[model samples]
Target: MSSQPETYEFQAESRQLLNLVVHSIYSNKDIFLRELISNASDALDKLRLESLLDSALDADTSDLHIALETDSEQRTLTVRDNGIGMSRDEVVQLIGTIAKSGTAEFARKLKEAREAQDAAASAELIGNFGVGFYSSFMVADKVSLVTRRAGEAEGTRWESSGEGTYTLAAVADAPQGTEVTLHLKPEDTEDHLYDYTAEHKLRAVVRQHSDFIPWPVRMETEKPKEGGEGGEGDEAGGTERVVETINSMKALWSRSADEITEDEYKEFYKHVSHDWTDPLETIHTRAEGTFEYQALLFIPSRAPLDLFQQGARRGVNLYVKRVFIMDDCESLLPDYLRFVKGVVDAQDLSLNVSRETLQQDRQIQLMHRRLVKKVLSSVKSMRTKDADKYRTFWGEFGRAVKEGLLSDYENREAILEVSSFPSTHDAEEQTGLRDYVSRMKEGQDAIYYLTGESRTRLENSPHMEAFREKGLEVLLLTDPVDEVWVEQVREFDGKPLQSIAKGQVDLDGEKDDEDDSAKDAKNAERAQREKDFGPLLGWLGTALAEDVKEVRLSSRLTTSPACIVGDADDVTPTLEKMYRAMGQELPRIKRILEINPDHPLVTALRASYEKDSGDAALTETAELLHGMALLAEGGELKDPARFTRVLAGRLAAGL
Candidate 1:
């Protein structure tokens, strides 16, 4: 007799996730079958690996495969796999609760994908979120799973209505492998709706999604005899029930690139990435060295919606000798290349390797370094062979690639070579550092750049005024990561990367027409201006002493009244904002305040300061100039309200 089923409430988060999977993630309902099959494949893989370690678990490992059954009248579809089944406790933990970390982030990405109608992103998100099983709730109102672990005598049956609760019971005659039977909803039977109970639909979905699954996926179907002849015990004119294997059961990565077609590569990409769009680049490598491995990598045409989420899972599907080890093996690639999707099959890795073991494995580390070089080479090829496609790739994942500049010190040069950026010279297309350097002024010594949150704002920044006047191109770096990378990438191709908002900039390099007389006159005029304004400079510096490192005369500014410049080792305003966003506390660094010597506003301020060095008006003008400079450089004012009050008072007095 079966034991009475014990009831358990679904975790609050799991219940909300169920509703989201069923209603919101609706781009492709056919993914339910794919997810179920993939889970079944995972179970088989686990069992296969375990059987190798423990002989007792190999009792019935001879015919390892998956089976599908459909019942039209009963309104049910069953997917059974002769693989590792869950124990009672395992079922309670894995099925009953959403135990994965980053549940909130997963839910947020799902909502964003659904709202954007990004079908590819929504589909890829399910597997990464570890909620593929809950996706079964998308089609079935009720799902029942029964199975017994390979070494266990008793089997557990788990049933859930996806309505906040589930039931579990012990069964005596349950199979050794897992069997999931879904009770399709009423709408699933309506016209034009998907009929999961149909054998043809099941075959098509299995072929499309699970064709490359290492194990055979068989389905039972009834076929009529062409001739009126009976075979063995079959009736002469009746149809015969026959089981046919549907999947190719071949590992795509195990094959040579010459044997795989473009269409096959695309189909495999869709299966692995769950992306409806084609890949931007495909890389296939077969390395036969001290550690042998086959890698098939793809660069997607668009970035995943959750690409930047904190602690987002990365890396490719790891396989050992055609046996699937894990969905994501983070050790295979660096975090910066997390957007890459594909499979890595190594013959050297143990089938029973765990995440921790993979991390410390020397062979794995060697393979990782090689793989990084291969991916970088592939990207470099794309940049050289196809500029348009490379641009598309850059548009999608350039910021992610930029992280490599900061983290992967060894490959920084190659990454910079392929990197693209928007520049002050061209607003329509992205410019490479090589192109920017090639177009540099004859005497330009540094590659000038400006970092900000937007291109439009960066273009109008007072910091870029002198660079623009000198016809010098400046790289417009808008990505938040750019600020961090620029620090690490101090120079590119022997030219220092100088921020237009930082340090002194000299573009007057050896003027041909400037003889000793011209130089003398210019120096004399500059000396006189400094002598005449020295007291005024000291007074203004004292007025804004707390806000600036040093208030000095400017040579970099042409038209702007004042602009803020960082010291040689100071952080950019953009970097400061990023640090605050990450909840980090950094030592405060004051910026240098540079006043344009020729601007009318500064001239007037100098005159007023000379008239009365202790005047309140002079102090107000100094504070106002500092506030405007801070605002113009995209830095926030420490006391915007007070600045506003001072400005209002000055305006009121003028009126």
Candidate 2:
């Protein structure tokens, strides 16, 4: 050990980055505790690495774990670990510089890391980086680290307030690992430092973030020791006080699903999700064979606060052989299922490479395929016993799940079993594609769906009239996102996506040959009527030329005068407005105005053309008919102001 003292100053950029890391990188003040403990773990890991090179350094090590000590009077907290210790020179290089990337480097090289993009690599990033060490600055007026390398000549003391610069001093006789001292801020000082009462908060954080760490994360406990020597000096001598394990430290995924009860699952979810509510449901499965894996997955009852946000929280955790490897494993589940929580513990995967290396590896591809299947199967299973619960889940997360079919081709069918739509059968029940297929009539092959902004609107829609009249079930898809999901899916459960609102639908028979005898009769009658008063149709088209897209006879509309349908490759104006609502720029599509020949209003309008049908009131009534049709199909009426003006003028004239 060096009797002579040494001093080192931090590099300028390192100081700035350190300041940013400590003050701004983390949002929670308690994060400083995790950072300091992690620093201690890093020292221990460093010593362990050195032991591989030098056996003498391993002579005094007992266990690899993090421990905490707090002094109330001094308002200081210390986190110590015995994994790997570093020398004086290394301490000065690391603590004084953000380059002391031992924590960062270890993250890239965690022995517990699974293939990247696998669950474990996510945990690897949390394990890596200097940001954690700097996080100590959040709750401390000053932070001090004393470390002796496992194979080095001496220990070094590094001190900082996280302001700008740090000073390093050579120190004597520290054990093989590292110790971090945080001068607690005033708010958490007295109560937090008293006899390590941080058990409550520490237990919460460990459960939330670090439950699956490879080593047992030990915390200070005060259980009554058995048969203490009745000392008057101690308050708990007669009661017996001792320290015991606070965390179960058990790998939950490795256990059987039945063995884990509801409370345990909920608690574990809280630990994994950092959430306050119990999980809605959990799926625990042990997969064994070519490659063994265990998955403990959860679905929250309520939508996560961050679910719809861009770059939202990816709540699932990852492990390898019961060792915590990553948190927020977005790649483990598709982006659509980001609300899912829990861990995937895999066997037969190597834990020797960096996080990036593992993500692109072949093992990840295999695991990913399997993981998606398992989750989709679990969601499908939810549909059997507790349909109402599944319906509630669908209402919150159904859109996201629909994306699974479009995005993950391998699991498309399984995801289809989970896609739910509002059907004519029940508003409360979300009809699955499988159910829709099961209920389809013989010789009726198409799966019908209608898109709208609301179920009430869709129920009243002229678009649904033909399907309803033919005794066909139509899926009521009201979500704005549902349109894209349906378009992307294109087909499901062996049936193609058929929009009921599309032009000239023939639900009764084949498209072109739909009731040939009836078609001939209707055409013959229309020709006779046309000869009787032919000028009206031409003149009505001229009267509302600006609004109508060829005032043609309608085959689709049964009860309504007319309804708007899109031209080929054109969007409905309602859908166009929705796009604009989401900040999309789009051009207007002129609607195909279809006329119901059976309606008395149409017959009257035709006959009136023989007289002075150019009357302003009659012209306004014709324009009103066009506006009503557009509104009927969820189309926005053009010239709403003009329509208002015409309505007001006609009402005044009638009054």
Candidate 3:
């Protein structure tokens, strides 16, 4: 019980964090008020919960509320709360030195959630990070905190400029609560941050960010006196100071769906997501089973700019028993559904649970699984009930949903049902796998697809020529993730998802009503072409040995001179390029070079090789054909300069 004033240096990490808070912790300075208000609400909640367990603690103060006052002339904003406060030593520990274990554990949890893209976990750990109090330094030059523990004889006064050191001393006869005063920085006021000192701005911010705060947040304001009279003996007409409760003090998620309007949900979404557009979908659920919780989830109409950024902030606000716990808890939903925005308030969880504890909480895991199912169900409903809207959703988040096929094996079937892709039948329209299966040709057993950089390119690809000629539909997969999820989803609805660009194209079906003679004639013609091109194939295989796995007469190609195909067991060229772009290196797999037997270039080359099997011109032709195939497949040749020179020589020779 040292009553003497004591000055102490902040812990090393605390010092660093203090510096970050003052300079760069938060992007928006107005959030400082939100942070303070949230902290005040938390203190009140802690006291309320403690009173339930210990009746003696409630003896002094039964009223629990937060008061916000602003002094424009003094450039100070004060937030006072009548709740559980701290003694001198408690002040030193809580305000001066953040617990190393708690800070480290919270940091680790945040990093893990971010890395895993666990938006739910990230959101739930925000206020638990032990840094909310420091956020005040973002807009304030100096901060003063005075607090008295419940039933304690004295309170503590803590002052800091947020530099490196802080002062603490005990005060006698202090109230049983905490009051924090922030001395706004000159630049903050000059930058118009003083607007927060205005009553209107304060009201707007409170309603926007903390409308659902369970306890009343009161603010004092001056209003015109009724009947234009101050009082009986007042000198002149003046405004009267009145206390107004600013927050709605109602947990919106706790309300029944029948009671909440669409507009209210949209406003809540805007408050949480900071987005202006309406949500594409809203899912509200109140689970009353063994682990009770209420969730209100939203799917935004547009993708966020950071949706693809690794470990981006994508979490829903988390509360327990109507008490705000954290924002951006990443564990409540799976990583693939990071675009979902909303709040989850659980009655089964402890309000005092730490982030580290939440990482292993069974209730969180159960809620996470439940939430993923709900979100996917809502998306599926959108696809069936409103296809055009679902298409809009797919355009924005299809890749992320497809990624679930790879990461969330349990939900792959559900995710697949909602996926859509461009097809050869329609350049502008997209089709789901089920629809493609329904339209399958007679005797067709495999679902055909082609992956490339774009729909227009894939549709015109030489690899798809045979499928197009056969009147078979081919799905044109243009997304970068298409190659990945396709591998995971080898087949959909019992038919193999065969890539037209990979392996060999086989669209086996019932034969046409051609006469036996016509069929025999066609077979004889193919036999002759293969025999005549055998020598050329042998010569080309040797010439392009380093670049190709094997060269053979094409059965699939109908127009282009040559095309490349990956081995049935190897990665496709598109996927190989994607891997390379990501800085990953896999052993390069050679491509099978297939030459169109009907193309004029192959016919002439066969005739040339027939005359002289060792002709150098034949070797140059083989190399040029391989280069053209590479270029057609969106591949880069190792020797572009040499290919250009060889091309120029060939064109000159033709002249």
Candidate 4:
């Protein structure tokens, strides 16, 4: 027997990393047991890989398992595995520091060989990410690693307190593989992660996070209650001990979606989405042409309160042959569809596919296209005379549909079909763009739309004035998503959807700009009144500077004195704000300010402007009028202070 020596202090950097890992990296300390066990499994994988050249290396090993032994009094958890071990020099180099390539790098390099043959791929084994080993510090106060490499000279013991410094020493011959011992902290004793004596807690942690790790994880089983007699002369008496596995992870996506029940799908969603809400709809499909793969996608019923929270889950889970290979495989779908949750599982794909291709998988692209169409169809199916259901679905996932429309050109038509519209439509009912197009009046050549920042604002828009007069029902498109989707889906069912604010709108074949001089003397009188304010319009342009591209008479304005137009191509205020939110700062554009001469405010403005030809008061009043228009059109006020001051001055100075 050898005498024990003084335990060494952790290195400064190692101590910092350990403290961070134990205190910050893992929210649960029980993960230390999982992490340490995972490392033991990793060591086993290393020998399995090494057996490529020498099959006899681990020939004597049986079960190839990792076992856990816990002692409550000592507050220690021991994890042992019968796999590849380590020598004194190897342990010095490997566990002597943190983050050294153990088996992960070697695993990646074997992919090319695996492609040549399935047997070859299986023959070459690997345990990637040496960082998983450090995860032990998340739960344990200290850990001791003892390993003996296959066919190595002597076993090595590496000790770490997670304060950082580690000590390595040679020991007598040990079995092939590794053993990890964890000294759990007092805080951990009460927590699920470290409460090994609490069978339920241990079972929960194993099931929650490590259930799918490809090996048999076992725990001591408790006997059932002595319901029937099992005495001295009975069939059985003493309690029996058994090791039972907690995780039985079967590849879900590899199986047919029809074969998987809704409960299974929901469970997978909970695991993948990290979300608690049930899904509204599911779009599962098989893509057969060119490249082939199965997809199981979900639409969450309720938007997560933290859906837009920074670093929230995005992109479909990606799997190869039913193995969860990566989580953020953006290639399965476009960014606009990021709200969708589920799996894009590739069958023939190499397990070692690059993240870039996982980002741009050709097969996945086809699968994604098919899925987008399916989800859109599902949304379209939700449209019913039942207003409540439609509203519920819309309230939860309507924005996501608009996102798909704007960003996915291939599926724009389908996106158009499912998207909802607020129309001069029935005040109580919402209609789909497809339904709105279906209800278009005879000779209606386009799907006319009017947008504002809010449903209330768009309903009262002056932009809809002339359309209302013609009995033409204009779609009040008010979602922020509507702004972008309308741009992408410029047409629906071959009838182009045109914004009332853009291009020329004709109500009964009359551009609002055209004069109805042929009407009557009353119309003639209205025309004359507009001309009487011509100088006021001119003064407004100067006072607002280029804020009003062309201040003109009103044919479109019915009740309001003035209204801002989506008058210029690059000058649309809605577009400007949208672009600014995307991080582009644009200068305000001049709007075409159309004033209603019938309005009392405009009549008074004309008199004030004519009386004080160069009065600063007149200029300020013009500012107030323009501010009112911006407010009506859902345009943001560039100078809020000036708007308030001008209105206040006008109220103070009376008609």
lDDT of each: 0.83, 0.67, 0.80, 0.65
**Superposition-based RMSD of candidate 4 using all C-alpha atoms, in angstroms:** 11.4
Show where candidate 3 strays beyond 4 Å. 1-64, 70-210, 220-248, 350-361, 508-528
lDDT value for model 1: 0.83
- Give the higher-TM-score candidate: 2 or 4: 2
Write the candidate numbers in order of decreasing lDDT. Answer: 1, 3, 2, 4
lDDT of 1 by residue, 162-214 (tens): 88899999999887889999998766433234888878888888877778888
Pick by TM-score: which candidate is best?
A: 1
| lDDT by residue (tens digit), candidate 3, 561-624 | 9998887777877788889898999997888999988899988888888888778888889889
> TM-score of the candidate numbered 1?
0.86
lDDT by residue for model 2 (579-651), tens: 9998999865555667777788777776666677667667877888888887776666678999888878877
Find the 10 residues in a row with the least total lDDT in model 3.
121-130
Q: Compose the digit string of candidate 4's lDDT tens values, residues 373-460.
A: 7766766776644466568877776776677675677777776666676678798677777778777777778888876677687778
- Please rank every candidate by TM-score, starting with the best: 1, 3, 2, 4
**Candidate 1 — which residues are off by over 4 angstroms?**
6-30, 52-60, 71-75, 89-142, 160-166, 183-201, 221-242, 274-278, 289-291, 385-388, 510-521, 580-584
